[model samples]
Target: MRKEEKPKIDARLLELLACPLTKGPLVWDEEKSELYSRLAKLAYPVRDGIPVMLPSEARTVDPDAEPARSARSRRE
Candidate 1:
């Protein structure tokens, strides 16, 4: 059988979560499967249905333009 897709994050938990460093809002990014903390400039990854919220585990992000949509979008 094919592997099942990861489950979506629970709405309650998503609403309660915020950026650990900045204590700012966390935006759920479905396309890249990440939780973006715009103020902190970090993108926490969602792996195996769980959000990895640690700052050390977060990837750097660009606020002006999302890297996920930048390249292809700019070309068009």
Candidate 2:
């Protein structure tokens, strides 16, 4: 028996994706399997490698928080 591998979001797709609300760039958090929009202060989920870009689907994030700030810094 073989183990199933989890799907991963494509790099090109990430580059093209943006926050639906602020239209700002997003940072990918591989550990959390979510895309963070610092400008919008939201974390959009990535289910089965498909990103749910809808603002309603995203969870509110604290931009000043350590984790959120770390994710943003990693991108820069």
By TM-score, who's the top model here? 2
| Lowest-sum lDDT 10-residue window in model 1 | 67-76
| lDDT of candidate 1 over 1-76, digit per residue (tens) | 2355644666678778888999886777766778887678899998876889899999998777654432212111
Give the alpha carbon lDDT tens digit for every residue of 1-76 in model 2. Answer: 1336545567778778888988887888776778888888889998887889888898997766614433332243
Global lDDT of each model? 0.72, 0.73
Per-candidate TM equals: 0.74, 0.75
Q: For candidate 2, list the clashing residue pairs, or say none.
A: none
Clashes of 2: 0
Model 1 CA lDDT for position 23: 83
The whole-model C-alpha lDDT of candidate 1 against the native structure comes to 0.72
